[model samples]
Target: MFAVSGGGRGDGSWPGARWREAIALTLETSTIDNTDNLEPTPEPLHAGAPVRPDSPTFAELGVHPDIVRALNEVGIERTFAIQELTLPLALAGEDVIGQARTGTGKTLGFGVPLLQRLRPASADAENASRDVPQALVVVPTRELCVQVTRDLADAGRHLGARVTAIYGGRPYEPQVASLQRGVDIVVGTPGRLLDLAEQRHLVLGRINALVLDEADEMLDLGFLPDVERILRMLPEQRQTMLFSATMPGPIITLSRTFLTQPTHIRAEESDASAIHERTRQFVYRAHALDKVELLAKTLQADQRGLTMIFTRTKRTAQRVADDLADRGFAVGAVHGDLGQGAREQALRAFRSGKVDVLVATDVAARGIDVIDVTHVVNYQCPEDAKTYIHRIGRTGRAGKEGVAVTLVDWDDVPRWKLISDELDLGVDNPVETYSTSEHLFADLGIPAHANGTLPKAARTRVGLDAEHLEDDGRSGRDRRGAPSGRRERSGSSRSGSGRSGSVRSGSGGSSGRGEDSRGGPDVADPATDIAAPRANRPPRQRRRRRAGALVGEPATDERIGSAEAHQSPVPELAGQGETTRRPRRRRRNGGASASSQANQTVDTQDAAAS
Candidate 1:
């Protein structure tokens, strides 16, 4: 049996006495069963059944009353399976390895305990004066960083716990300034967090708790080295927690090396499928060129709200979004090719109901948790089963039913079969379907008369342009359609040192440097000094000279028509005190002629005489 005593202050007036009493009673009565009998597997704590009326609330789990109140205010009273298993061990300062499927409320599972253990800024004078973070949560992607920061901030609002998010693609000045102002918890990606820590801007020496969320994703993205470096910098006595959906080999080794006697908890049953049972999935064989037409009809399905379309490449994501928007559908795109401001703008538009369709690539869509998503469409076949699971996991979240459709081209049929076999999806050979196919309409609940374009009456939602893009303080070169990296030649004057020389600008022309009224070098105004047109300029003349004297008239003259007049003069060679022209050699039957030899002998004699 495990037990934890809870109290906020040392004055003996227990602030969480009711919750502690409830936790003690539950721990005493409940019998925790070890579901997995495999050797080397830690005893797993199961929540038994899904969340119900009799499920334990945050208060009953001995969570801080302030956190419980904040969670209740947001209509989150009962704990999910993962949260129920994690809260007790984590709140007691024990290291925990939490494994759960996506959208199983993993953020709050660690967030609540992390917030409860930390001393809030308003309450702790010593820690507040130091302005060092008490807890750190590291995520793999920028999207996840934002999501976790928002969740933790909402959960710790009543406790006055300051939370800040730090990630790449945004200006560093703002994040550094936020850290300087002090925060109770910091949630960030590995790259940006390590950069700040190496620069001495972030202080991790005083951290009391550390969490690596999405551990498997971090390993896949090759962030384990930076994560390990960060872990080494923290105090050794602090508590560590790791949460991931899948446990690969590297993650298991990581848990063994860093975590101390950690309790392994799996929220779901052992025999359960990796995919959420509530999600309804369908697969179809589609053509490469007809994919857009097929996806358009899928978006028009009955009762479809906030659909997400996934593509394999960044170009395809943007292309699908453009095609949909051209067909009068409100759509936005999130991919690697877009600027950070544009990506955030698309997500904001999608979340605010401004855009009903969002097109995104795999990496860009990581950690996006948008509720109310009724449909997820795979515009192209996924690479493997894991990607397929992650893609469909976006829908069917939080115990909601969702519809997922996959369109596989002829070339990707083999890949799709492999994924189907791995997951036991039983859809090995997909039905060959097209935009006009009757079964597609029946499967996804599309109207019988639906076409490739959206109707005028259904285009009521505002488009992506309606969302105001925030200025991320990036240079114009970072924006799309902006000028290249080369600086443009402007008419603005530039001051130079007091010297007399031609000051050449980047326009490939020399600007005359003259004295101004103040006796300083005058800068040229490019706007007023436009070059003359070629037609109006005088024709250039060419003259021939030999032996330091003009030998022929201007070559442009009509009188100079003979071949001899057009011949080039021999160049004069400088001797000791005389100049002699070298005679030209003539090849006659691949040998020197008698006249050429005689001219050469005369030139040599002339040089010897000088």
Candidate 2:
């Protein structure tokens, strides 16, 4: 993975063009667009009267007037639903468990409270020169850490709160230096958090407010033990806020183990609300290789200004974006290999519409809130329901109708079915399709057979034909078409031959035939049976009868010799109509073994003919 900057290579050529094309083709072909005449918007649905704070202002949410002024300066006049629900409780120093989806103003839900809780360095001279962070917000991946830290800094700018992010896959010295410089809040992933803790470079003992953003994801990554250890190191009286979209058993277990009887604020997402009301849910079954194609087509449809694509892997994220860019779609990728600066640059381009698509892995794209993301394509169906929700949640933000297209591989049928059932999203049986499926064009609102024949610039943004894929020889798999839409194996890597567990059924040799033959019993020969026809049987009769002619009785064995004259091996005289070939009789030998062998040979041929 080459380091990319400014959305292009140093030479000014778009480095992601190949990837853009690949992604476009995968998504466009794989997605099955909805034809259900359901309009995009529905009615408003909220649990209670919109929570009305005593003072309907930021200052009433325990935010210092100076902080409120700072927030107001940034155009944040009123608190969002999440901020209103979580701020009052957080300001009161109570542990909180806030359940909300992405793009729901969750950053400020915890950020503002944490910033408000900050206290100037203690008067102790011994600690005045030393720098130890008082807060830690642990996220799942590096990209989210950077995104979260930036938001926290922006919200806390006037308060002069120093926020720092430390995540893995980059230089450690800078993080250590940042720690030395005394950051007020440290946001990072589990591995780096543990590393820094063990190195004694960052201390959490004095942490007053510990926020576990996207807590379910941290739990999913097997970081619960680390999270527990980190929690143990913090002050016993510290406030712990666990936030996630969907709560699972493991997360609940963690909350029970660590968080005090927290305020259980459940902000349910309603299909009738503006956010959920306008979100369009489309489900389709398609070949795995064709996902990028399907997405390409969807992105090009309706001129939806910006889109974010979610894939299950970093490699897939890169490939999806690269495929789209190659097709001339202004696209960029955000994942682990990129630097914070590089990731930010790509995101800026996407937000500004300079780049229409941002392909990202689930972990990398978390906490990234880009408004009016017209479409969010799950290039690959997520591993489970929670992930599926998060991937699509990127779109449908800020009360705008957004489209989410999920491309399901055939193998993912079971997994996606479970998600569909759980979410009540009536789309469980995805249509089996490939890149060439006519339905794909209809779904994208593109004319069938329009591929490649369109103007180059228009085609670049979407609909790549099979002729453009790079050759990396592997096996008999078709490169020009979409993947077979088979489920990807859990640990099976995608090789040049493509992912495994493919079903092949047609005319072919059987592997078990040889084994069966080796163990089977042999059959008996009947060539020399005394009761058999003498050397020959009459040619298979094709009898024709006169209109009034009578048929004769069949010949008996006793008269076989007389009738045998007509059953000659050679053709009968020209005047004769038909003849039967006589089975060659073996000359009898005095030796039983020789005679038996000859009879066996004759019987084998007779059996074959029969």
Candidate 3:
């Protein structure tokens, strides 16, 4: 027989019944908030209290003393505040959500604990090269992946805990081969991590602990979905630690969903005091093209040890790099288009001081953990408030104050205004100026003429004279009638033809030859006049008119005679025969004017009678 109730008195008041009821209530709350039932609240931050180490001896933390000696050999004396707080919780197998900025030494904070729980990876397991990784650390950028992987490998050198990093923009075959052998710990960006997982080259089922470094930046890059999917693929019993600069709502929600009773650790507010107080902030409004000039001047003025110039696009980053290179500066550009090998080369060059300046896009800027960057210049305004903060956060790290200069274009005023408002920077209307303005020199703390220092002899002290440049770029009179410094003449006299014809400088008859019958040189034939006027009237009406008309002669039949006949004579030729022709008297028909209509009718009647 089935018995559902635990009460002997047929009522639900028995202790056993109460126990059942309590279990049900706990399950209900667990559904609402998993943290409520699984873990205890985290410890609060103490300003002056000295934090204890996770263990008294290396053996106690499950690491050999030789490994501890290796750490000491590298000049690591004491643990950072985040390491102190997170190590104990992470080692105990409890989930942890840590809030801390970059350069706080959080890598070892989560890394050391993950290494403590790892079993000697199998020799034949996929990706298990003699000392390859079993632990996986997902970072936001390829740079961070390489950095964190290197740090972890150094920390595990004595333990022979092999580490490898997998990321995009590189060949996948090598990564696949590495996985085929085996790795003790794997650090990579979310995209490559998922790709390896999906390809069956890497497996998360055996990963005992998973660390998501720079969780905020991962979210910013729209990597949360990939992070969530990766979490689902891991064993439910695995340890999860999330580290980020800030604890926003999404971080909290993530903690609730993936982490099982995570211990929240945040450094004392004073921890951030050194960074905030030391860094100097400046904002200015200028044209987009002027940013290059301003950046040049600022770089010359500051002479900082290392500088990182951040831009919004890869094209701009390349352009800034090219401009600086042309000006004889040692510069490099990092963007998505470069192969992984090329990108690493540039980063290495910049880090080793072979390159003085690094121009990079947002993807390259975020997650960059360079230690000595003294200045960060936003060559172009960022997209949003978060990006603005992240861009400047690159410098002013590791407890040293740094300088941040932002160049805001006119079109980006509204976006910059929002970011400035949020940060309380009071730069709503940043100094409206230009690159060549005197204020630019003063603001950048440079001489007014930073253009170039030319020697006296090279200055070419000359004055302008009344010399005109001709069409051939010579300075003399243009008597050949070609285009000169004056505005090129338009609307040629040669109609419907190229400008190869000459102008009529003098008056003449048909061929500029005199004619006996028509009086002066024969009027230029209407069809033969090359420079004939282009008026709308018929050509016949435009022919030159005679000085005197024969009485009663129709004007159309007589035609117009040359006006220059009496004024000039054709030059005589020695061998030419001159023909003397008699002038013919013309029989003329007259046309009456409109005012003489009645007289015209009488004349016509008389003619008819005759």
Best by lDDT: 1
List ranges where model 2 is wrong by over 4 Å.
Answer: 1-55, 122-127, 271-276, 287-294, 335-345, 432-439, 447-455, 458-610
Pairs that collide in candidate 1 are none
> Of the candidates numbered 1 and 2, which has the greater TM-score value?
1
Worst 10 residues of 3 by lDDT: 23-32
Per-residue lDDT of candidate 3, residues 1-610 (tens digit): 1123332323332222112111000000000000101112131111111223441443444545655665566445455556655676777877777777665567777878866666764544543444444577899987777767766666677777767878764557778888767677888888888988998788787777889899988987889999998888888887888888776778667866887755556642232344346567778888876777777777765446678899888667766776665454556667754334334545655655556578889886666666567888988898887677667766665446678889888898999899878877778888876767776676556556565222334222121011111121111112112222222121111221111012211111112132232223345556657686658545563322232322222223333243222122222222334522223232235754332554556678789999
Q: Could you tell me the lDDT of residue 280 within candidate 2?
A: 75
Cα shift from native, residue 84, model 1 (Å): 1.2
Better of 2 and 3 by TM-score: 2
Worst 10 residues of 1 by lDDT: 492-501
Model 2 lDDT per residue over 1-610, tens place: 1111222222323222211110000000001011111122121111111223442568866688767876666456566666666788888888878777655566777888888888777754444567578788998766567667766776677778888878764456778998998888999888889888999998887788899988877876778888888888888889889898777888877777787756566554553343346677777888767666666566656556678788888777766655665555666667654434345545655554555667778876766656566888888889877687667766665445678778888888999989888877787898776666777667756555444222354533321111122212211111111132221111111222111112221111112222222223323336545567765776665432323432232323332233223222333323334533333344446645433665577688789999
TM-score of model 2 vs. true structure? 0.62
lDDT score for residue 66 of model 2? 69
Query: What's the distance in Å from true for residue 399, model 2?
Result: 1.7
Segments of candidate 3 deviating more than 4 angstroms = 1-64, 121-133, 247-250, 268-272, 447-449, 452-610
Compute the lDDT of residue 154 as modeled in candidate 3.
Answer: 65
Residue 418 lDDT in candidate 1? 99
| Prediction 2 global C-alpha lDDT | 0.60
